[model samples]
Target: MLRIITEPTEAKTELERISGRTQGGETLQQEAAVREILQAVKRVGDEALLDYTAKFDGQVLKAEQLRVSGSELDAAYHQVSREFVDAITLACRQIKAFHRQRMPKSWVQFGQDEIVLGKRYNAVDRAGLYVPGGRAAYPSTVLMNAIPAQVAQVPRIVMVTPPGEDGKVNPAVLVAAQEAGVSEIYRVGGAQAVAALAYGTKTLPKVDVITGPGNIYVTLAKKMVYGVVGIDSLAGPSEVLIIADQQAKAVHVAADLLAQAEHDPMAAAILLTTDETLAKQVKQEVEQQLRNHPRRLLTEKAIAHYGLIVVVDSLSRAAELSNLFAPEHLELEIAEPWDLLEQIRHAGAIFLGNSTPEAVGDYLAGPNHTLPTSGAARYASALGVETFMKHSSLIQYSPTALQKVSNAIETLAKAEGLHSHSESVRLRREMDNG
Candidate 1:
């Protein structure tokens, strides 16, 4: 059962438990394991990758069988139902549209005397996306991670996922990748997969950036290899904060909270409501709904460990607590959601009204579902075209423009006691004068 906190003091304690240190107590061990795996991959290249695939994923795949071929992708499409294929295609279109609008555009401006300054946006040469494939198939993840790279015009988009016991990738994932326009797909995952992308193996090429969520091992691996290669974020367990009022439906709120709870045992599901009666009702509803979910065990563990229902004095207090938590997914299930929306200052993604559930954003809604987890919403944002592109500042100064700022530059340089720095500008000024 979820903890019920009524007093402000209890609320603070419960909120700490919910938003506190993420999947703690494993950082050092995870970092060590990741370092070992990364070093092994770095030393042995493709051989180490293959060995780890067998040891961890239980599939002994050769280098030739690592990359999924065109025929295999076609077969994967045939494996899934037509409805699923159509749904994937539709999702691809929606995600593509959302990212297209958010893509940064290069711009140039011509100032007087050719003192031009602007920026140019360019996509990375290659991007590697990791898709989790342990308990469930994540075709949606494939679409979320790969579509932005496609929209950003990445030259090559490669995806890595662990193969199943049969040494085959999930067909649904393959179909989604094909729909999202991925350039390559590999059968690898865990820290080994991250290593393969960071330091290119004999078969897998090193990528400019890696994106997507995974378990602790994968997250730590990304963190260790950050400078060697770019990573999206050091994602932690999933989290959701629902701000509801007496007018909100307990069942909907409960279901939404459980949606994130079922993601992982460390996942957090928090409910902030003004009505004590509603808080109790929603807690009961969550347990009742859990009975029917296939992942009831996992959801139950998550709720028992980190879940909480806080009864605040007013809706404003609820909003304040929600902002403090900075949850990955925040749902406003109240009478006037939009009115309270202005009160929410932080959150990765906001679901307005009862109809707009977090699940909608996860699947078909035009927003990228890859969000910042573990209070990261306080600063980071959801995955988008900007994540896959690089920005370069453009600057140009003509002789006249240089002359306009030469004196100021010399004065500042001289103030810093750098004679050489000032002399560079002084020399140029002398040439102009001559």
Candidate 2:
């Protein structure tokens, strides 16, 4: 059952607790366990990956069978329906087009002193994509993570996913990977899979960056391996904070909340509304909808523990509480969504108007669905092409340019006690003068 709170102070306390759900003390044990998995993979490579797959995923895989075969990739298309293929193709095209617009270009600027300065953006040599597959198949995640890397022109895009107990990867996931231009995929997941991507197994190539969402073990592994390889973000569970006005439909709002809750038991769904009646209605509606939910036990646990509805004085107050939460998905079911959007400073993604739901963004909306969770939206953003690429500062100084700034450079270097630095500038100027 969803809880409804009318008191603002109580609502804030509950919101804070929910926002910090990922940082609970229990993670210390999980982190330690993840560390062992990482070390094991780093030390033994493919041998360790095979062991962990058997231990964690309940599937025994040979070193040779660790990588998904071309025959399986071809069969994935036949396994899935034409409707799924068509939908995935549409998502791939839409996602690729959107990311193409976001691709950062290398630029150079000629300054007053003929000093060339700019930034050069280049894709990493290889990128590893982690697609979670436990409760559901996330072909959308495949397209979301892989398409961005493809658009960024990452030379090699690799994917890794956990196989089912039958030791078969989801056909839909494989089809999505193919549509998104990810040809190299491995049949492995969990912390060990992350380590293999970061440190490289005999079968898996070392990648420059890893992107996607996963369970706690996967998230911990990504966090631990960040310095070894770039990561998209330490994504927490999925979350959504919706602000609904009187005009918003109670049933629609409740469905949106449940849509997020169904992702995981730790996922959160919240509502901040000025209408007390609507808040109560949504609360009732949430329970009503969950009665026959396909994922009832899992969604019920999420709703019972983390789901909340708060009745506030105004939309401004709702936005204030929302900013404090920094929700991963924010839906504005208000009459004037834009008016409230100005007050919202932080949110991973915002859905405006009653018709717009977070599901669209999760699937085919232009923006990336892999967003920051656990209040990370305050500082982080949705994963995109930028996650698979890096920039280098480009600088060039002509003789005249060096001469003009040599004295200042030498003074600054000497002040810092870097004699070689000062000498380098002075010698350059002297050589140019001669």
lDDT of 2 by residue, 175-223 (tens): 9998888889999999999999999988999999999988889988998
Candidate topping lDDT: 2
lDDT of 1 by residue, 249-337 (tens): 88888888898989989889888888889988988898789887999888899999988888888889988888888989999888899
Candidate 1 at 34: error in angstroms?
A: 1.1
Q: Give the TM-score of candidate 1.
A: 0.97
Q: What would the TM-scores of all predictions be? A: 0.97, 0.98
**Candidate 1: C-alpha lDDT:** 0.89
List clash counts for every candidate, in order: 0, 0
Model 2 regions lying over 4 Å from their true place: none
Model 2 RMSD in angstroms? 1.2
True-structure RMSD, every candidate: 1.3, 1.2
